[model samples]
Target: MKNIKASMLAISLAFLFIACSGKVQTNKIPNETKYYLPKGVKTSDKVALDSKELQSYSLALEKFFKRNVKADEEKKQDIYQTGIERGYFQ
Candidate 1:
């Protein structure tokens, strides 16, 4: 009976260790276009726009892209830091 209880305790502890382990899973595909504008913005795409609208759209798109890139970089950095903290790296 004591041997059976020890075996069960060891199994439970093994499962607890596995459950508590932190593993980071990421799905980041390089060279994949993740953002799109509803209306076409490229010159060769043949989307027409007036001077004022075009200027406004350009500014907005610039800000949007900058914000997204900054956020992505920050998230990547955070993941890297987490990996380091979890002893995945030296």
Candidate 2:
């Protein structure tokens, strides 16, 4: 009976060790840092702009496009005129 009890305890301890040791540990805190470089961009040439700087840059580009949209349309019209003069199509 003592031998049986010792064998049972050994089996239970083995099972507990296996259960605890085989558990998959997850990351408690996620890393915000990027692991890989973006496609088509070199690591040395890249600049890390802050969110506010990016927002301002985006707004500036939007405003510039809005301001020069008419000029771009005029340039397109000139290109069409030149194409017609060159007899690109009948």
Candidate 3:
């Protein structure tokens, strides 16, 4: 009985660990998943990117984008260059 209980406890712990492990789902963004935009960016209307104001807006967007992207996934130089080209990072 003691052996069975120990085995069960170990299995339970293993299951819990696996359940709580870091698994970033890179599949697809659900339609319900809304992105949090800055106060200046209007959610409804299309607004032109003001070069002066773009810095703040870009920073906020970069933060949000970075949150989902894993560090390991950002291993290549292309990713860094693309971000720079797209004006995500300065």
TM-score of each: 0.29, 0.29, 0.29
lDDT of each: 0.82, 0.83, 0.82
lDDT of 3 by residue, 1-90 (tens): 999999999999999999899689888766776866788975657768788688988999998887745665665567779899899997
- Candidate 2 Cα lDDT to native: 0.83
- Candidate 3 lDDT (Cα, whole model)? 0.82
* Predicted structure 1, TM vs. truth: 0.29
Best by lDDT: 2
Collision pairs in model 1: none
Model 3: pairs clashing at backbone N, Cα or C within 3 Å? none
Report the C-alpha lDDT of model 2 over 1-90, residue by residue, as the tens digit.
999999999999999999989877686665678565578885576768799999999999999777876777776757678889899967
lDDT of 1: 0.82
- Sort by lDDT, best first: 2, 3, 1
Q: How displaced is residue 61 in candidate 2, in Å?
A: 47
